[model samples]
Target chain A: MNSNMKFSRKTEELVNVFQFLKKKEIEFGCTDRQKMEIDLCVEEVFMNMVRHNSTAKNKIQISVNKTADNKIIISLIDHEDHPFDITKTDDLDLEDYVEKKKSGGLGIHLIKQMMDEISFEHQRGISKITMVKNI
Target chain B: MLTIEKINDNEWKFSGRFDASQADKATKELADPSGTVTIDMAGLDYISSMGLSVLVNTYKHLNEQGFSLRLTNLNRHVRDIFKYTRLEQVFDIVDPTS
Candidate 1:
């Protein structure tokens, strides 16, 4: 089964996304570890969209699908025009000291490390990011 | 929702979601404490990048004042987050039982 949802750019809407994912995890037979990773990935993607397009009128759409190969795929679509491919972002130097490390890239870094594969596409004034994880 | 409980002069217990929504409040509640601050995270099951940034900034602020920060009772998931981000090298994460 696949699930789809639309949410505003407000941070408060994250609760609904989390709840939706939790229910999907149970139905998809996701392990606790897989659930945690997926949760973090969703939070990072959703929060990034919220922060970047806080003033935009377009709503974000999220879809989750489970494949026959025991893989979970999540897609996040936003209507904002600015081009951004999180998969192409540079990795943060995880070894840097706390005072010297930059915080800007950590969110994307965590998402990259947690998910098995990520793909991004921009077309017709929309940005679509798809993340896949094997269960 | 997030709740912060002041246990003492330099100790606090945090519970609930520590994500973007609660980042500001959590930072404010944990601010301006003296000495080595110990944060109890047993009840905190979730944290996001915003929460991590708050913790890093707090650690820096306290260190400049000759103080330190300690985190305890992190669940396996949180621990994995730290490990993934290499935050385990920066924060003093300890066992709750110890």
Candidate 2:
């Protein structure tokens, strides 16, 4: 199954995102745990674009598709071409994070840990983040 | 819809999805937790990064006051969120069923 959506830059659109993902759950046929992780991954990528990329003028596009080999692929596209590559983010030190009580990069860290693969592509002033999870 | 109910002066019950849109409401309800704050996560189905930040901020605030935060009745998924972030070490998580 394959589906895609375009959302405004505001965080309020998260409700719509959840609704979209909930519909995909039937087609994805993933376990409950996997569903939760997919939700997290999508939310993190979507929020990152909304929060960090303040200059983004266009709507963000998100797509979900299931591969032939039973893998779920999620893609998020930022049309504004703000290139913030999450894959290159440094590994977080849990000890230091707790000591300092910092929240930065935590979302990216979770996305990395939960998703099987995360790839970034930039071209023609568009930033696309693709994440995959094995069912 | 996220529901944050103040069960008492030190305990709050969180139910439904706690995502980015609900973070600000959670933050406002969780602000100024006086004593050892206990958050009941029994009815919480989902929590995103922004939701986690609210908990972390509350923990920091309570820790500075010579108190700490406790999370109870977390579902497996929510528990894994803490485990992945290694925040289990900082917050006292209790599983009544276990």
Candidate 3:
């Protein structure tokens, strides 16, 4: 609750959006290792949002706020009835690519593994996902 | 996060963190090593599955081209990553950097 960064975008903007978000995280003093993990994971989640909402016209709101304990909390808010929690995707055999890779499940799995905590919110016609990590 | 030093005769030494974030351009550069190439990962910190995928893909491509792919300077961390993926048997993992 110390601070926040908000962004609005359509699905098309997600392609290279991770690069920008990653740079911003670095600016906030996230360690390089944490930055790399968060950057990769955040990109995956954003990419998922875009894919799931192919016809999404609403701009997503992403906020990054610092917690009292000097941690970073990230939230992605949308207005779609996305059925899955997205944090529960199963792991993949890192060996298989073409078959398993096309599914694109690794990103979510990796995110789940890297982040300390990931949770989603769905109420009042808004879907919000927040990821927290102690930096 | 990886360091590259061009050894004489077009060989290059690679060391440091080579993860998904660091693979794209490194893959491109490694794919075309300019000549016989050697990668030294003794100082490698850690690598992701994506990193290994990149290395395996490059290895396949290089093998087809009849180009010599020299792998040396493997630290314990790098070796463990390869071992986990069973890539230890696929690519040449050498110790002697010479």
DockQ of each: 0.66, 0.81, 0.11
Give the range of the ten consecutive residues with the poorest summed lDDT in model 3 chain B: B77-86
Where does model 1 exceed 4 Å of error? A97-99, B96-98
Clashing pairs in 2: none
- Candidate structures ordered by DockQ, highest first: 2, 1, 3
lDDT of 2 at A126: 90
| Residue B13 error, candidate 2, Å | 0.5
Chain A TM-score for candidate 1 is 0.93
TM-score to native of every candidate shown? 0.94, 0.96, 0.56
- What order do candidates take by lDDT, descending? 2, 1, 3
The C-alpha stretches of model 3 lying farther than 4 A from their native spots are: A1-27, A93-103, B1-98
Find the candidate with the highest DockQ and give its number. 2
Cα displacement (Å) at residue A62, model 2:
0.5
**TM-score: the better of candidates 2 and 3:** 2
lDDT of 1 by residue, B12-31 (tens): 99887788888889788778
Candidate 2 reaches a DockQ of: 0.81
